[model samples]
Target chain A: MSDHKFTRRIFLSGAVVTVTALSLTGCTEPKTQLVKIEQAGAFFNPDDLTLLNDIAEIMIPRTGTPGAADAQVAAVIDAMMMTWANGATRDLFSNTLQKIELMAETLKGKPYSSLTLKQRQSLISEIDVRAFSDEVPDYAEGYKRLKDLIFRVFYSSEAANADYVPIPGQYRGNLTLDEYESLTEAYSYGG
Target chain B: MADEFDVIVVGSGVTGGWAAKEFCEKGFKTLVLERGRHLDHPDPEYTDMLAPWEAENAGLMPESFEDAGRYSMLRKKGRLYKSQWARFFVDDKEYPYSFPKDRPFMWTRGYQLGGRSITWGRQSYRWSAKDFEANAKDGNGVPWPIGYDDLAPWYDYVEAFAGISGAKDDVETLPNGDFLKPWEMSCAEQFVSDNLKKNRPDRPMVIGRCANLSEVRPIHTELGRGPCQARNMCKQGCSFGAYFCSLSSTLPAAERTGNLTIVTDAIVTSVLYDDKKGRATGVSVVDRKTKCLRKYKAKVVFLCASALGSVQVMLNSRSDARPKGIANSSGLLGCYIMDHFGGAGATGVVPGFEDRYSFGRRPTGIYMPSFRHEKADDVDFVRGYGYQGGGSTRPRTSHTGKKVGIGAAVKEHVGKALPWRMRLIMYGEMLPYIDNRASLHPVKTDDWGMPLLHIDAYGRDNEKKMLVQAAKDAEDILIAGGCINVKSSHVNPENHIELGSRTHEMGGACMGSDPKNSVLNKWCQAHDVPNLFVTDGASMSSCSTQNPSLTYMALTARATDHAAKLLKEGVL
Candidate 1:
């Protein structure tokens, strides 16, 4: 469920304060809080985390709101890979990363990590277009899965600040955008 | 005296909860035996409060962690099985049952203090007069000893206490109950309902009557229950007591009476019978974890374990006088098994109403009571089916089968909500066939040293034809309401829908007039054994195309009254 009271810009800015508070000594964690940001992204090595982080940022770049990087979607992915993914899924992701590196080397004469932001963006755009196109080859399939996962993880994250109501006491069958927005704003935060 | 209770109710699920509440309220010392681990009210294991991202893997369980082979059915079913809420469901590797090698039966179970009532689909509907008379009219199975009139008062009683949310829709096939205010339909749903009324008057669409408390009553409030918050995360136990469950409503009421005792991890192995006295004296139980045996004495025993659960227990309760099984003189303890056939439906997008969107996730949908209920020349099936569907607006996520480019553009695209799209899934009554039955596997036994239930139920011609008609009618209704791209799924040729998928399994120890042909009587009392009663889905002579939990609760409450009266009058 999404809570739309605070916009992504507001939530992203507020996150800086949250991070500072989290690091402060003698400040107890929230009672019901299960997972922390530090616990995530531990599955992947430094190089893989870097690649994942950059690719996630490219997939959902920061505009007027927080992007995939701010959402820490890549960290979520790493956590999932460490704990959730099976052998088959892990292999698929690993191979897909290797393929991306190979593609970067073949096209721009360097590894994907070594490329400039502009070069990486152009290469990713090419891959994204080819992956979704009707004439997509088997190689592009993994990219489609990766792209979908990135979007899914980002949207589900707290940084996305999508309109969600954990507990709206009543149901309204029909409402205008203005009415819905006001209602969500009123019943915003929940555990 | 320490091990004895006035009444022992086996299983603390939908029926068992009601039984405990009623008997305890009536001042009987009731002991509820649960085969699973104890779960407290507002269960600590609940993930209902967890945010989407806060859950591990965003609520998806890791593939490597779960057992693929043992939980093959759940693995194949996907989604719900692989969710964080899978903690509520039983592990198949531990509590295994068997069916035919070729035919798979998905017996979805939750082994906890509240049982499957913790995760029940909450849709509440009353079966009509036609449902009761179907068996006799069609000469299929035995006639129901009780009719709609017999259960109407009981239904009213349960509906008041349980707090059903439904309108008085004046539909004969679906009788209205003592209800709280019904949940509101979405704008798109209202439009479709109006259109169906104007054009297809015969097929009326009404709001789903569910167990969720739309408005809290004094009876519900007194039990510490509150109004539904429209969170829709009910599968994970609700702490607010907004939705009706054993842990939320009935069990707490039972506990307040101070006449109720509960024993967790006590698997009821059999009902101890006294042949000379012609009474069920007590229950034999095995400790789930330690495998230690114990017996609890009771004046009366209510087998409110699920339909199959009761059937398995009854079939295994063999004695010298009743060599086949206790209270099984009819030799039909595990016969005429029935579950709703489903998985055939239509989905389409409504053209307009883009600007209108509903606030709060209402934990209900629209229900179309079966128009094919009566005998008609047009229809080839015996019983009928109902459609549970709803209209909703969503952004073009992965669920919508749309392809969008990456980056800012895709993010923007997903932000804007799409027009309301509608989908309908049908639940048709599976005709009670004698051959489609449950029996003990000759040799196989579980770790508890109880016989493994071998389910052999499958859909026949009636179910197949009904599902096919259901799909056609669903598409026709959507088309009439001006929906586009109406696509209907076809029934599988091999096995119609997987048996027990709908989770409304009913009919094994069926109630009928003749004791020679049935296990129980009109009052759900065992004919051969007076003090033993089955008030669960097991006593149903006919499985109607409605959610059966409400009926089971009503029956348990009514039967408890009858049993209590008899106990006081020294009838037993």
Candidate 2:
């Protein structure tokens, strides 16, 4: 109940901000503009953000469900980078992504954007296999982290198309199968 | 305002909070002084308000040796990670102490109005008659002046007030409390409990007796506290006031009395001893920020600045009446230190509970009471040990090898529940030795300019023996409880000598009948100075096999009541 109220307020205030911004500008000069979802973190640099967004779009392409890029997963991850990563972690994450991008280009035998859809998917799947292995190869460790982060961000984003309720009253110690199935479950591992 | 009050409670943690509440409610103008920052009933510093994804640290502190080397013991435990709530943990560089070279003591200090109470494992258990009698029977440490009978009433009082969550067990070792409501055991845990009951009746496994209120009573509602939401993010400071931390419970109650005055950032240096009156007048406090000195007078004083922290105060105070320090007549002030002997146990899979799992975190575990010399087949060790562990089913996520599955197979495996595993950690009693003591550091000084505590403590032969016995017994118990793939035992050379890492440090100003051997009396008061008290972990004469905070709260309440009565009777 309260979750809906808070989200509604957020949407209202967001709309107000957009209106105020548009009114203040008054002139449409659509040139040399850089777009960003969250400008708070180390990953907010446009180059890194664009690369992460492209990687996410390839991983979770729009089918029936909203894609990773559609949910702004990269922007969220970028914001989280500031809170989560120290210098060492930040370097590890960025360096690993760069290595993966190079590997993917080499595997496809072409630049990322110019590659066929099948070739791009094939490269992702190949990386996914190495990433999901029992003991991740030292080379695959960065891609593994990147893949895990993608899934984590995607599930927690608006793309999941799930409802939320704050203060989930009195946790049930024992829930029958029927009761669980009967209820409209909106599961989240807390944003 | 007035610098004088009827009672002055130093170190507003568990005991200090209780002291304030008890004294204030009794119509005594009580001043509760906290050395750290102020915190109110509704915690503003809680990480529970932040979602896990929102907090990139996942409401935990990541392992960072660079954060402060002092948290070396805790940093590995992902639960203690850096986030909004890690602020509760003191930065070790600012407040450093020295321990023995061989023995690495991990002293985690929670420096806030609530102190370590905010971060403590809420496991609340009453020490049984066996626990109280062990020291006296074994002839290791000084005999407890008061026993379970003396403390039974106070335990009931604190349990009711604190709103303990536990089931009534007719068992002798683990006595039941006046619990509001008991948290239910998981299917796997229940299986283990039932199996233990049927096969090994001597080993009773029950739901952990904890201070988190399973159900709220009107009294708790009056104190602006509610029931445990079972979110299990309590270490972040319970935003709901569900757990009985000093901030959520006692301090708030003290505030409600309108007779309580709380002064935060007041680092108490020493007790101001009076020569003529043979009493403690008040305390000398330095401003935590400005480093300015100030004095406050009270008819009675309670020292609840933790175990070693209180000892620093006693050793710092210098007076003509008792030259060594206030009430240090015997020169036995910083002696006979004790902590729960840990670092030995067992872990294994209870294969039968494969079909069972639990929902929502219990935030507590099963407690196996001490076997010691109680049974017919007794161990060679003097004191006993108890196993505090839990049996839970979690998704099978441990996979590490050169060859492994990928894609859908790995995803499916990572998302499913693994077999139930029973992990147990044995806590044996550490026998007190006079050599294992904490005194003032010779030259080193903290930010407050007070002498840093030099804790020279080590595990002895008896503790090593206890660990060995505990390991063997834990293995036996696990196998008997129908466990498979058992790692026979978990005793190690490094953990055996873990000095103060358990953070259950007790003694120094221990309570005893004889003033020659101990610092405090039966009422937890200074043997020489009646008006002064040390009701925190410092007053523990013997280290029992359970968590000691519940005992500390009871002792604080009992001492304040006694002091109030004595003050009314016109006694010094």
Candidate 3:
């Protein structure tokens, strides 16, 4: 299995790099090269990529199980946008990303990527309040769609199946509710 | 040139397959006509075997297909799940329909050999004595010419062949059929069932009886099929043929008889009625692929072209004897439509039981049989509905706690989540009203120049009241069972059954004792044309809440046998 690894420095840099220098020497084929950025991953704007990585890490940081970054959620989202999503879904995602960037620029005079952890947290909290409120209809709708898509892409990834949600081999219909609950909870928690 | 055949049965769906099978098996050469293309069973185009990671859209319907207008009603019914398996069944561009501006009908349908049987929910239930006697007692719609006893033996015959897996829940209202071992329920489901039974002694919750073969019988095994893998991917068309479908079961059986001749893409335009013989001689068919018109001869003609599809053919077949439409003596031929008004129920989170876990995904749910018609005292609605529900643990959600902090709190939150529970669903009855009817489109014509069906139907006041009450009753039961966060929602009245969408769509050419009241006789033969038989949903007198496929199968079986007997006795 390919190791889906990303570093903070490599993510921040706009230039794409390979894990091994041998591929750079032209001895190996481009398709065979491991640890290269996926096509879907390439769609993420360099600045937006950094912000997404940072926010996802905050949402589901590295624990005993792999986090959102480890699941390649950004790549999934990028693929979803390019292939599956229609015009409206793509617009919704792009608009939300732009809103986050603009909000960060207004608060700190810098991109969301350049913001401190504390500054990012405060900005997100403010956005969350507005997003969750019934008064802010547009933001609420956007947030719900954004939140659902993010989770759908992340948890449904192969990474989550291996380390997070374990697929059972057989169905035993007589198991108790508590038993089902614990297993599901554990699966959700990336056990 | 009009192609000739010994027998031509319109619509290669559930009823069509049965009629074809019976005729073929009896050593009579038969030609099966279908409006749609052929879909091979076992290796059908859409099978949900692909993993989530492998899927292009991860089960979200593509907007392009939705925009094509063929799936207008289908999109609302959760049929638009965008996956690898979606392409085979969902084709919105080729098949389309137009509804009234004020009344929108979601005609959720697929035109193929197996028809909607390829993607049916497979919940099988028997109609009791009450369902058979409903129209007779109520006097609302035409009374069923035949009673439960006439269909009982046929039900056993079909069940034995189809391999219905269910437990015999000895309820008088819901008669038990020939069943295989019932599929097991989850621990949470068992607890809820036990508590509900003990508390509410009137209502009994039994395991859902489905057409899926839990354990393969010798008959099924002889046909080269095996037991179900418990994958719960039935909507994609089971590759193993563990579930019953026209492609997987009847069509194959007919093929083995060597008397069945299936001609795909042959759209039946009208039944050629012989005025002198006072019978349908054959059918005029148009090749959907080649745009060529042809005629076929047959001793007996069966119109199993769905409910509305059959009605369309009947209404299109104009003769001097019947000017309004074929066998339109009563004018009740295209009236009194009925469907199970679905999407009424309450869901809630279970309070306890955190220790139990289940293994594989069981395909079926627990069914709460009808408690309304136990002893008919005054209820708001005339007919009652049954609840088909089950309990399940909550799956993962994508809510990130403390949105902007890359810390241990986020890690901790993702590590220890709790499992929540919810109910399956309930479907109530929509009373058969004369006003709720299907008629030929005034201006619209299909791709083949056949008149399109203009279905303007809705649930009546009684149906709305039944749904409202049923929703409340479901909520009360869940709350009484110590459930939290109980929420109830009613599906839009316009959305229920899509008018002719359920594929269980019944009663356009209903059966009655008198020729002035119904289109087909008790034997499913048209009253005006002796040799013409309408054995599909159009022959149903009333629409019971139970999945109507099994009943259609039984009725078709009985009708074919009766037709054969009548033919041999020189009655025609």
Query: Per-residue lDDT for B1-572 in model 1, tens only?
Result: 48988999999999999999999999999999999998898876776887666655655555754535545556655766645467777767778999988788888887888888888889999999999998998999999998899999999999999889999999999998878998998887888888898989898989999999999889989988888898888888888888889998899999999999999999999999887788888999999989999999999999999999999999889966666777888889889999887878998887777777678888999999888767689887787888998884433444211354667776665566777888899988878888888999899999999999999889877877877778888999998877888998867745635787887889899999999999999989999989999999999998888889999988998999999999899896
TM-score of 3: 0.86
lDDT of each: 0.81, 0.73, 0.71
Q: Rank the models by lDDT, top first.
A: 1, 2, 3
Candidate 2 on B187-221: residue-level lDDT in tens? 66677788888889989888888988888888898
Which candidate number has the best lDDT?
1
Task: Compute each candidate's TM-score over C-alphas.
Answer: 0.92, 0.86, 0.86
Model 3 bad stretches (over 4 Å):
A1-60, A112-130, A133-144, A163-170, A176-191, B66-70, B79-81, B88-93, B319-321, B348-351, B374-378, B392-424, B479-503, B569-572
Q: Which of 2 and 3 is ahead in DockQ?
A: 3
lDDT of 3 by residue, A34-68 (tens): 12232225355544554555455555555776667
By TM-score, rank the candidates, best first.
1, 2, 3
Candidate 2: list runs displaced more than 4 Å.
Answer: A1-47, A53-73, A105-107, A116-168, A171-174, A180-191, B60-73, B319-324, B352-357, B373-378, B392-409, B494-496
